[model samples]
Target: MKDFQPQNEEVKAIRVLLHGPVGAGKSSFINSVNSVLQMRMTNEALASSTTSDQSFTIKYQTYKIKKEGKENIYPFVFNDVMGLEEKTGVKEEDIKLALKGHVKDGYKFNPVSSLSDGDHGYNSSPSISDRVHVLVCIYDANASEMKEPVLQKMKKIREAASELEKLYYPS
Candidate 1:
């Protein structure tokens, strides 16, 4: 993989977006990827189960994987979003904006408020290198059933990713 590199010098890291229901292990997934890349166990991304209804992750965080003993980081980044809830979760509008590369990293999300152009974290014009190239939807297989609203939101997000010509992978 080290030998394989993007042909274009202008191309930066490939951004992969992780999104799913609360407690779906999105953060854990990122940590695992990092661990594998670094060849050791890591807890760089906070991941914990919560009894409360709110999401454990409240901001848009990006995780970079650096190979062991390598000075350069991998040509990829995993972007984790707030876990989705049945009623109170990341706004679909905000997700769409993110898919289109309008949202920036480290942006805090308000469960009750959707992001807009006026937001300080908003990026009016993001280059292709800043856009998400892949979207991964995580789900808990043991869950009895998926909520209708949440399912609908996932579908909308998939559609939005499609509109942005991004890849959508279900996990």
Candidate 2:
């Protein structure tokens, strides 16, 4: 995997990461946002893995939401990844991949077996010129508790985002 680095400090990309545990309202939230905004969806959600599974979002998808009564278009990309399980071991790679671009035509991704050990799918780095935006972490309202693991995951995500921001915008 390439070292985590930023390429530019001028271009800002409106990148929003939607993460949550399994059965969270991530997919539904994306759909609802799309519907309410009446934005033209430029891309569809992809399977997170090659294997046929109910929960895996195979591909990272992008959607374009036009501003309300404006000529400008806002591009929103939402990636639905596999949930955080004890043995899946694909967190880091999945996170990096989500930050990367979507799957190419006929290109296949390697399934991750270790959380931190996997290929960084895209070479794209964060850019300050690209408006790197928000990360919305969804949660199941019915979950039993926000235990240790859950809290840890949230912390890591925030840390990663902060680091990225620093890299992209050194102010």
Query: Residue-wise lDDT of candidate 1 within 105-137, one digit each (tens)?
Result: 899988888988878989999887778888999
Give the per-residue lDDT digits (tens) of candidate 2, residues 99-118: 43322222233345422223
> Candidate 1, which ten residues in sequence have the lowest lDDT sum?
162-171
What is the lDDT, from 0 to 100, of the residue 57 in candidate 1? 87
In candidate 2, which residue ranges exceed 4 Å CA deviation? 1-13, 39-54, 66-73, 100-120, 124-132
* Residue pairs in clash, model 1: none
Among all candidates shown, the one with the greatest lDDT: 1
**Sliding window of 10 residues with minimal summed lDDT for model 2:** 1-10
The TM-scores, one per candidate, come to 0.90, 0.61
